[model samples]
Target: MKSMAPTRKLYQEIKDIVLLSDHRSSMAFEVSDEVLSTYVPVAVYWIFSGIYGLLGYLEGCRLHPKGAEEEENVASKLQVLRGVLLQQVVQIAVVTLMMKVVGDEGMAPQQPSFLVCACQFLIAMVVLDLWQYFGHRYMHVNKFLYKHIHSKHHALVVPYAWGSLYNHPLEGLLLDTIGGSLAFLLSPA
Candidate 1:
């Protein structure tokens, strides 16, 4: 019985992290602790991407300065950045919703071998790459689809760091949300 105490405590701690506490609110959206926790890594991505993109831009524009003709105006870049931020908000919402749906069903760690975990991660990435390639290819081939959904992304004549997520909602959900969901779904956590 003494051995069960530590395992039980660990489970309880995980339960505290995964469970949703606020389902009722008058606001359009509420940022709960669970949501905030998930947002941290994504926020880090944006920060690092922005920094790298800024450096790249400065290098290209200052040192080499080749594509000045095609370089977009600051206003246009800001507009695209706004769109990226909006889509990130959508992503956060989708993640929160998925968490609510998946609940605590498979949160337990299986303590799989390093090789097994690496293999699962690799397989998941390959699947995601294939889906994204096909999904991206299809969106471009269909003009109507591109004009409606994918054009926003292409508007960035020369994209910056935050430009990574300037896609429209349709493309965003199909590419980002679905691909990521597939990876997590395939992995045993």
Candidate 2:
């Protein structure tokens, strides 16, 4: 039908973006798209975290007095790092499982135009923000959650980039790993 022309064209453009002519040769060393998609975010997280961690050590760049911040913090830097590492391990397992369970399903088949991509990005941000807000609020409002799990993160009274992910294992699993996996699954991009 005449009405289908624009829809078909849009679909075609998406298809062009998503599907490669050759999956095996898509990358330099035959790395699959899925593998890159799976691990790149994880690698970037640690890389950026390390950068931030290093930056936090620069006394001249600090926004707050180190003595004041240190006085407020109940947990040690080592403890925070350990929590972050443990959470990252849990996140990797959850993400890998989720990817295996729903590989390429409902994803846009091709690349979208600039306008489309912009819209998708905005929508994804809003969705993720709302998801995080509600999840965080729920944890905060519940006494049990705050006392047992979320308290671990709150121990880091001095907020720093390196301590950003220092949450209890259960809280990290529920609030971050699952929320992020669901967000990725729900994203059309």
Q: Could you say which candidate leads in lDDT?
A: 2
Judge candidate 1 at residue 82 and give its lDDT: 78
Summarize candidate 1's per-residue lDDT along 92-169 as a digit string, tens digits: 887788778875655554567889879888988887898899989999999999988887777766666667777787
Worst 10 residues of 1 by lDDT: 20-29
Off by over 4 Å in 2: 1-27, 67-70, 105-109
lDDT of each: 0.72, 0.76
Q: TM-scores, in order shown? A: 0.68, 0.74
Candidate with maximal TM-score = 2
After superposition, candidate 1 runs with Cα above 4 Å error: 1-37, 56-75, 105-108
Against the true structure, candidate 1 reaches a TM-score of: 0.68
| Alpha-carbon deviation at 51 in model 1, angstroms | 1.9
